[model samples]
Target: MRNREETYGLIVETAYKMFAENGFDKTSLAMIAKEVGISKPAIYYYFDSKEKLIDFLFDEICKEIMDQYAFTVEDLTVNNFEQYLLTIGFQMIEEQEKDVHFNKIFNEYILLATRKERYMKQLNKIQKGYFESFSMLMNHGVTIGAINQENVESKSNMLAMVIDNIGNFILTGLELDYKGIWKEAVKSVLLSVRND
Candidate 1:
């Protein structure tokens, strides 16, 4: 079972690199199999299709991004929230900007999702999970008297939108001051919800 899991990991990693370099539509299961030095059948055994493989890869990447934030609801005090938004949030944007290939592949997947119901569903699930994470953080801020209690849901949604836009800008390879823009946007959201 352990060896099988390792092989599965290898397949996913190989597929991600290939898709990043060559694109999702252009990268084939056979190519991934070859890169992993496994048979195409082995790839099929783990993931029935390329779309399934991409979905798994996307989930893994999202988990990594979430993990990078390294903050929880308990960490949402006024001081901590500002520090996190400035430090960890900026770090997340910077890390994302460095992954040019992955960003390209991500944007491509988003575009493809618009045309395919399965892809759309998968994307929606990932997005909802991210939004919930932001909402949880906002709820904690309210509890700690760092944020206004009025319209917590709307404030959370707005903050989440700012984060999403920053990510989208990075993923689309927009030539702008991402960190500066992110800081400004986050500050704006925080000011809007400030308890003072």
Candidate 2:
């Protein structure tokens, strides 16, 4: 009774659930079809293979990050650049907690990153985008003398590393005590930016 769009939605939704529950490698299309109460052939009508399903999910997660970037940086300018980064970090942690796929993804990708270079490329792209955004913000800050003009690349890379490390920690179920860890980490990163 479902339309093609509905069937595709069901397939994606079902696969997402299974992937979250058992991770990408453990989850199978047959299991997803069973979970959706559909035949494997029927499921294939929507998703031809598990890799295709994962590809779709990967894009979906990347889109979520891209979408959040808009809201997180909407009103950000040179004056409040630090606050902008902090806001985005905290918001991302909260959003990652709400979505099981996000958490599963961190675990899955980190565990298999070396063996999965193509998928890892997606992760790299997202991280680089984050860095570029921060670099632009830092450049603006320098223009206004709020931040240093020298060593922009180094400063941006360090900031990006801090954020990436934080995300990795959170994904590992490490209690960051954000208020404590973030303040110190931010200060250190800013010191590098200001050093220039």
Candidate 3:
């Protein structure tokens, strides 16, 4: 018999698979329970409702991004700043390459935001918070004399836009060299930090 943690993990993973294969609206809790070989009431023990399950999945995805940020920026220093940007850019590409399912489901939530005011507000808040967070880092660089003071806001915006959309860009199935293009894109930010 699965322990409580094991049952919860199975439910979440199975629900993500089902949600990715079928549209979120089309995937019901009963459907997930059937796929997991569990009773519908058992699923209710883990997730009270389908929306709550999605909320859990979405939160998990966000948690993944936040967790990555911890390690991504943990070693940030002016000396390694350019390499830092490249590392982050390339990592974004790699993650998107591997997690297309999460990307698709995330986009589905974005589409849902179009019709649902709560989701729209949440998306707006998340995007703005993302922008501000990156901008704050750029400002810190300026304060520390690592990043140039000129056009810091614009630089932050450009980099944040690229970072935020790497998943969407991958989903577009463009065959362009993302790493090379990102190298070109970060050149603008690199100029401010790089001085021989």
Clash count for each candidate, listed in order shown: 0, 0, 0
| Candidate 1 residue-wise lDDT at 18 | 84
Q: Please identify model 2 stretches exceeding 4 Å from their true place.
A: 1-7, 68-78, 110-113, 189-196
lDDT per residue (tens digit) for residues 61-164 in model 3: 76676655543445567777677778877987888888767777888888888988877876676677777777877776676667888899999899878866
- Give lDDT tens digits, candidate 2, residues 1-196: 8787877788788787778779888888999998887888888777788888888887887787766655333455656877766766677666665664667665666566678888778878887787787777667666656566668777767766776676666666776585456566556656655666
Best by lDDT: 3
Q: Which RMSD does model 3 reach against the true structure?
A: 2.6
TM-score of 2: 0.78
Judged by lDDT relative to the true structure, which candidate is superior, 2 or 3?
3
Model 2, residue 98: distance off in Å is 1.9
lDDT of 2 at 115: 81
Ranking by lDDT: 3, 1, 2
TM-scores across all candidates?
Answer: 0.73, 0.78, 0.85
Q: lDDT (CA) for every model shown?
A: 0.75, 0.71, 0.78
Off by over 4 Å in 1: 1-11, 33-52, 65-71, 192-195
Could you give candidate 1's per-residue lDDT for residues 1-196 as a string of tens digits? Answer: 4488899888877787788888888999999999888888878889999878887887776667557544566646777786676675687777777776667777777887888887688768777777787777777877876777787788778766776678778766668887777678667657756546
